[model samples]
Target: MAISDVPPADCPPWLVPVHTLLLGIGVLCWDATYILMTRRALATKSYGMPLLALAVNLSWEMVYVFYVCEAVLETTGFFVWLLLDIGLVYTTIRFGPHDWKDSSPWVGRNIGCILGLLTAVGCVGHYTFAVWWLAEPGRGIGGDKRGKWWQGREGLDTTELAFWSAGLSQLNLSAGSVAMLLVRGHSGGTGYAIWFFRTMGTLFGLILDNAFMWWYWPAGYGFIVSPFAVFIWGTSMACDIVYPFLLWQVRRTELLLPDGRLVRCDSQPASTASSDHGKKKR
Candidate 1:
């Protein structure tokens, strides 16, 4: 039988705990990210993540929980994230309209339907990709036993699947975050905590995890260290790194409206205007 047909080799006893530890850190970091996002969303009455990025992330988790993931811990992690995503989605639908009220009334009005449609489409798109990728001959089947569990079975390469899909997801998230910050020009629905947790999540989950995997199983995980993977994660890291500085600049110009909306002031510095407005009210 070809190597692909052969049963996966056993995981090294020592590596099992190490594997769990690495993935565990990643999971915790991402879970914290979701929690912080939800909290910030509620506080500002607006959504934190980009709409398209959220849809893709929710769909990715749904697929892994039902169709892709094999390990118990992995499935559990995806499922937990899914539950948190549901809350985040609710926040988006509930408060997203207020943010879009002035710019695009129609979008604010039809936000729920748009998100439903996007989620459905994302599900179909992600599932189709997984089906084709896992079915291809000799694809995604070269790793160790843990590879079979954490990565893929037979030709079902969860790791590579996650890399491409999650890589695209991260790109959308990181780039969209910057775009949102600039477009909004205020600290609405976002904060330093969200950025920090999200950045650390990517660091642990994608960059560090892949690096460790390659160190442990160089031959099996060569694709992870390849140029393509590097580019995807590297671009995301660069975007994340630049986010805080931009946020600082934007915060300086922000004005807190009486109705709890945070907006930018281009005509004058926010501190001067805020103080003047306070004096007038007094």
Candidate 2:
């Protein structure tokens, strides 16, 4: 936002801050939506869903914060978002049990078991594809002279690899949110607003990660055939294109209640939705 933050003409200096700031805003907007939804779930004590997004997103932020992004804005933004992920993870842990209490008593009784397992899976999934984590000398282990540990991975594309995780998460976010609306019905754990922010966040990311980089980085970093970058960029573009239409569907559909039940916004009152929920419970 400041004049000093601007980069040289040959390169897009402004992009770094823009990308990082948008990331932070997107994380907050996302988690804030979860917070609202979690509160509603807790208040109603209805059902709780799995924590796929929470685990995956938290893992991505961890990789970026510790191993990927190291600049001032980038680092600070990632750290802040990492903290928010913790909050979301906490919320999920708190209210996510009711989903399987009766259906799967063992899991509901000890949901932490699932979170621990997912965390391990998430860590491995992120590290497996993350380039810098495997190639950075003295970055992974305490004693390591040779940085390249794996074959065919010595010349890994860090930027694109980072976005692979990012892009997939974004796509997961778009698809999963639509599924969530169906599952939650009027359950109130999310809203169209969350999707709006999410969609905008990807647009901001594309501006820097794809558009700016395509124009600027070719002159400097050279055009690396990064599968990760290509994958994420393609996914981001695809998801961004579908987001608006999906958002429209959400608005056009029946109204939702705090507990995820459907109601007629024009004909039925809030009390009627509650009555419907009660009938379903019976």
Which runs in model 1 stand beyond 4 Å of their true positions? 1-13, 140-155, 266-282
Spell out the clash pairs found in candidate 1: none
Worst ten in a row by lDDT for model 2:
140-149
Best by TM-score: 1
**For every model shown, what is its TM-score relative to the native structure?**
0.85, 0.62
RMSD (Cα, Å) for all candidates, in order, is: 4.8, 7.8
lDDT of 1: 0.74
Model 2: pairs clashing at backbone N, Cα or C within 3 Å = 37-189, 186-256, 186-257, 186-260, 187-259, 187-260
Can you write out model 2's per-residue Cα lDDT over 132-222, one digit (the tens) per residue? 4545433321221221222333323444445557766666665665565555443334445554555656665533434554454443222
Per-residue error at 115 for model 1, in Å?
1.2
Q: Pairing residues by index, what is the TM-score of model 2?
A: 0.62
Q: Which numbered prediction scores highest in lDDT against the true structure?
A: 1
Q: Write the per-residue lDDT of candidate 1 for residues 88-166, one digit (tens) a residue.
A: 8998899888778877989899988888888889899989998887775446535543333323344444566777778
Off by over 4 Å in 2: 1-50, 100-110, 131-157, 206-208, 219-282
Error of 2 at 27 (Å): 6.0
Q: Tell me how far the alpha carbon of residue 99 in candidate 2 is from the true structure, in angstroms, after superposition.
A: 3.4
lDDT of 2 at 186: 38
